[model samples]
Target: MQRNFEHRKVALGTCGRAYNTPCIHEHSCLRCSLLRPDPQQRGRLTEVRDHLLARIDEAHREGWLGEVDGLRISLAGAEHKLAQLGELTTRTATVHLGLPHFSHLVGRTVR
Candidate 1:
């Protein structure tokens, strides 16, 4: 899904739900349950995760305690999406199986 924030457009990945529906998260896609992160967008999501981590650190040092909590929540969501991508990769990974042997069947007569 695309989001327009701060005069810039950001692609937050694809939405798994129905199309043409309004977002209830106020353009905060990371923490929303409806967000089905795209595997191709891993880099962007990683950037967001890193940014959130830095923001949390800055918030702590700058005494922005309230912001840190929200940042942490977003961080968790980012990590979760990353994990989902990882799992998808694992599930779709190639596996090799040996070719079938027909030696025993070679001597058998057809029914």
Candidate 2:
């Protein structure tokens, strides 16, 4: 049983859901059975977090505690995924873009 997986910005747990289950794909990455959360999808995840935050705020204003709670949990999970993805790639601290040091060229004459 080798399984092939594709890159997805938001993976819906379709495998676990038995036909017509209302699985909110974007908000369910953390609990997804087949979530391929890659570092390349960081930007999309960040945007999702932002959108969830706005929804959470709106829910709070509307006194919808249930909605706020659910949104908050999803928000936390997305944040955790972001942290994991963030650790995947590292930035080079010292990049040698300039020319190499040429101490031997000091004694060389122009041809």
Candidate 3:
């Protein structure tokens, strides 16, 4: 069966109604079978990344090597997604803001 799903309320951090897969894991979206993240989720993604970092730190401090390893993997994924989305938003935003593509050219002497 081909299952297709688009995330709905990311703020709630649950599978969207469109989700049809049976896979579920902690921070469901992290390991969801139908994980399809949208650019609009940048903010939430950042929050997730920060939380994962904290968890990784805590695990290491408590000598939980196994847990720390898992959290690091998830954290790397979140950071990767954030970078992808950040680049996309920056490109589109530059056009919308009527700014130069070369950031170094911004806010300089215009004589």
Candidates in order, TM-scores: namely 0.69, 0.56, 0.54
Better of 1 and 3 by TM-score: 1
Provide the RMSD of all predictions against the true structure, rounded to 1 decimal. 8.2, 12.0, 11.7
Q: Evaluate model 2: give its lDDT.
A: 0.69
Runs in model 1 lying further than 4 Å from the true structure: 1-10, 93-111
Residue 78 lDDT (model 3):
78
Q: Candidate 1 residues 3-105, lDDT tens each?
A: 4331232376766545555668777878877777778899999999999999999999999999999899989999998998888888956778889888987
Question: What's the residue-level lDDT of 61 in candidate 3?
Answer: 94
Over 4 Å off, model 2:
1-27, 33-36, 91-111
Regarding lDDT, does 1 or 2 come out ahead?
1
What's the count of clashing pairs in each model shown? Answer: 1, 0, 0
Prediction 3 TM-score vs. true? 0.54
Q: lDDT by residue for model 3 over 1-111, one digit each (tens)?
A: 233343444542435444544445655566443344678787888898889988988998999999998888788777766666667667754335565578878789877
Cα lDDT for residue 77, candidate 2: 78
Error of 3 at 66 (Å): 0.6
What C-alpha lDDT do the candidate models reach, one value each?
0.80, 0.69, 0.67
